[model samples]
Target: YHLAREKKGMSLRPPYRQPHHLASAISLIGGGTYPKPGEISLAHRGVLFLDELGEFSRKTLDMLRQPMESGEVTISRVKQTVTYPSSFTLIAATNPCPCGYYGSRERYCTCTPRQVTDYQLKVSGPILDRLDFVLSLKSSGLQEKAASETSAEIRHRIGCVRSLQHERYGSHSLNATVSYQQLERTAGFSEVQLQRIGIVCFEQKWSNRTQVKLLRLARTIADLQGSETMTDSAIQEAIEWRKLPNVLQGGEHLGPT
Candidate 1:
C-alpha cells in the first residue's frame, strides 16, 4: 500500500535483489521428495544485499540468471511449474579476494593466484553481466566527517531525474530502465562519441550485450550530471566501470583511490 501510494498510478516499487551465502544452503536438501524454497524469493520487494558475494556456490548463484533478466522465477514440480515475481534491484558487495586484502593499500593479500582465480570464477560471467551497476565501495577511514548530503537531498535529485524520465518515456521506469529503441532516439551522442566507443569495443572485444549496457550506463551518468549532452567524461566513466572486472581478471590496476 505504501509503495503503491508513493508511486501512485504506476507500477509497484522495484523489488530489492540479494544473493545468499553458499553455506546457508547446505541444509536445504533434507531427505524429502519435495524441494525447499531458496533465499531469492524472500528478497522480493526491497533491497537484496549480497555481502561477500564470491563465496556463494556457482550453481546456487547461477540459478538467479534467468529470473534477473526476466523478472520472474519458475519452479517446476512433477505436477506443475510455478512462477513468482522476482523483479528486484540487485545490490552486492565483495572484497577484492578471499584474503580480503587483494589490491588494498591497508593490508596485503595472503591468498595464492590460483585461490584468487577460483574465488572469482565462482561468480559466472552471465550473472555478473545481468547486474546493471557495480560500484566498488571504499572506507574513508574517518568516522566523524562532516555530512556531505542527506538521503533527502539525494532522493530529491533522483526524483527530479525520475520526473524527467517519466515525462520523456511516459513510463514509470527510470533512465536506467529505458529500452534500446528509446535510448537510440533520446540519447544524442556525437560522432566522436560513437567513434570512441567503437574503438573501445573493438580493442576490449566487448560483446554486443555489453555494448548496449555501456550505452545505457553512459546515458545514466549524463543524466546524473544534469547534462543534456553525453560528454566524453560520462562515456569514459561508464567504460571504466564496465571494464573493471576484465582488468581485475588480468591483475589489479589503479582505480579511484
Candidate 2:
C-alpha cells in the first residue's frame, strides 16, 4: 500500500496457490491446533486456482464460503483465533462431471444422471451464489486462428479503470467494497433501474447480498468504460452472470474480467 501510495513501482508478483486433489479443509481454509495462514491468505491480492474443482471434498470446499464473502478467513484454534486476509480472484477449472467427459464433444460421459447430480453437489448452491460471473465455454484444443489480446494489454485497460475508481472514491475502495448508499448515489440508479433490479431479485430469488453484488458488478461494468453512471446494459450484463449453465450446475465459475 505504501509503495502504491507513493507512486513507486511495486514488483508485479501476484501469488498463485493451487490446492488440488488430496487437499484437506485445514490446508485450504486454514485450521490446526496452532492456527496458521493458508492458501487463501497466500493468494491475498492475487489469484487462487482450484484445479479439478468438482473432485474436491464438499466439506472442505464449503469452508470457502465465509472468506469468499468477507475477504478474510478466521481459524479458531484450541488456544487462539487467527484471522488472515483472503481477498483473492478465485479461478477454478474442471470437467463437467466426475468421469471428466460430461460435456466433451469427443468423449461420451459414462456417468449416470444421478452420479452427475451427486458429483456436482460438491459445490453447493450457497457457494454458487457467492460467485460474481459464470461462463459456459466450449472445449477448445485446436490452436487459435486469430491471435488473442495479451494479458499485459488487458492489465493496462484494467489499470485505467482502477485509476478512475481511485479518483472517484478517494481511496482504493472497489465497487464490491463500497457501501450501498454510496453505490446507489454514485452509480445514479434511477427509479426504473431500481425497479428492474428489484424485479430480477424477485424473479431469481436473489438474497439482499446477491442484489448488492449485482449492483457492484454493474458499477464495475460502467467503470470499465469510464462511465460515471451505471447503465441499463451494464445491469443486464451483470444479470447474465448468474444465468450461465455452469452456475445452474452449482459451480462457482467467476474469473477476472
Candidate 3:
C-alpha cells in the first residue's frame, strides 16, 4: 500500500548511497528522465543535512556549489530544463578519516595519510568554501556530568533571534539573505568597529566572500545579544568561528609545521 502526500517543514537528510553515483546525484540535484525536483528542492526554505558528507562522491558533492551560492538548481534535459528552488541551509557531518576517528584522544586514526586525504577530498574545496560555517568538534573527554545545554534552551535562543530579525527587518527577513546595504542600514557599525574588522580581515587573508560571510555572521551575533549596533566583540567572535582547520588551510598531513 502507498499513499501520496506532501511532507513540509525542515528536512534533515540521513546519509545514503555509496560513492554518490550519477543516479544518486540526479536523485538529489535532479535531472532524471522525468525531471522532477530533487532533495534540495524538497528541502527548500529549510535544512538539508548530509550526516556522512564524505561518503558521497567528489563529483556529486561538487554539484552543490552552484545551488548553495544561487539558492536554486537548474536541471537540463534533452528537450526541456527545470529550475527548482534550493534555498536551504546546509548542515553536514563527517568523520575526520575513513575509520571514523582522527585526532581523537580516545582512538587512534588507523587510516593512512593518503586514505585520509582521499576521504577529505570527497568534499571539494569550492563546496567547502560555500559553507558559511565549518567547525571541527572534538570529544569533550569527560566521564562525569558536565554542564550542557538542552535542545529546548537552544531553540528558545534561536526563537528569540528569529523574533528580533522579524522585528528589525519586518516580516522575517533573515540576515543570511540581507544585502550589505540592508545590514549596514539596520545594524550600523561604528568607525572603531569597522577598523577592527578591517584589521582582522587583512591579517587573516580572508577572501571577499569570507569577509561578507563574516559581516553577516557578526550581524547575527549582535542580534543574539539584542543589540542594534555591530560591535568589535561580535566581529571577533565571527572571525574566530570562520577559522579554517589546519588540514583545510594548506592541505597538509595532520602534523606540526
Candidate 4:
C-alpha cells in the first residue's frame, strides 16, 4: 500500500492507517504471493484508527492480538517469512449498542438486552483488556460551549509528562510501556491505597493483565498531575476510566471493569 504512495513524497511523520470496516483479514493484515505489509504494519509508530470497530470480523480483529503484544506482525508465506513493525497506537470507536443508544441520556435504547450483549461483545475481552482507556462518551448536544485548554497547551502538558516518564525510566518508555517490575517499584502508592486497589480488583474480578494496566494508568494520571506520589484519587479516576460499559450477564448488568 505504502509502496504505491512513495511517488507522493517522503514523509518524515509516522504513517496513519484507517482501513474500512469491511476490509478482509488478509487485507487488514498482510498476505500476498510475496507477503506485503498491511494496514497494521503501515501504521507503525503512528495511529491505526479503526472506526466502527465492531463491524470488523472477529477473525481479523483477533489476528491483531499477537502483533499488539510483540510490537510487530509476522507474515509467513510458502517461499519465505517476513516481519514488519506494527507498534502503532490503536484508536477505535463504536456504538454502545446496535441502535447506538443503549445508555444515552436522551434517546431510549431500542435494542433488546440480548442484542446489546452480543453487540458489545463483538470486540472480545482479550482485545479490550489490551486497551488502556475505555470511555463511554455522550453527545455534546447544542449546549453552551465551555472554555477548554487549547490544543497547543494540552500538547505541551502531555510532552512534559512524557519527558518525566522517559527520565524516570531512563529511556523512551512511558508508563504504559515500562516493565512491570520497574513500574511497581516507582508506583508510589500508600499502603491504604494498595489495600483499596486489592479490594477493588477482587470485587471486579479483574484479570492480572487488567490489574497491571490499572496501575500503569494510575501512574500516568499521577504523573499528569505533577504528583510524585500516586494518590487514592488517581487510582479511583483510573478505575472509572478502565470500567467497561454495562455488559449483560444472566439478564443483568455485570458492571464490568
Q: Could you tell me how far off, in angstroms, the CA of residue 15 lies in candidate 2 after the best superposition?
A: 1.8
Cα distance off (Å), candidate 2, residue 9:
17
Q: Measured by TM-score, how close is model 4 to the native structure?
A: 0.87
Kindly list the per-residue Cα lDDT of model 3 for residues 117-234, writing each as its tens digit: 8988887766766667777665554686765988899889998998888787786687888777887677677877767777787887777777778888888888888787777788
TM-score of each: 0.79, 0.87, 0.82, 0.87
Candidate 1 lDDT over 47-149, as tens digits, reads 5667667777788767768867776676677866566565555666666678777666676689998988888787788876776555564546566686798
Regions more than 4 Å wrong, model 3:
1-23, 140-142, 247-257
Candidate 1 lDDT: 0.67
Overall local distance difference test of candidate 4: 0.78
lDDT of each: 0.67, 0.76, 0.71, 0.78
Of models 2 and 3, which has the larger lDDT?
2
Extract clashing residue pairs from model 2: none
Clash pairs, model 1 backbone: 15-88, 16-46, 17-48, 18-48
Native-to-model Cα distance after best TM-score fit, residue 246 in candidate 2, in Å: 6.3
Q: Write the per-residue lDDT of candidate 2 for residues 101-145, one digit (tens) a residue.
A: 775667787999888888878878777777776665665557757
Worst 10 residues of 1 by lDDT: 26-35
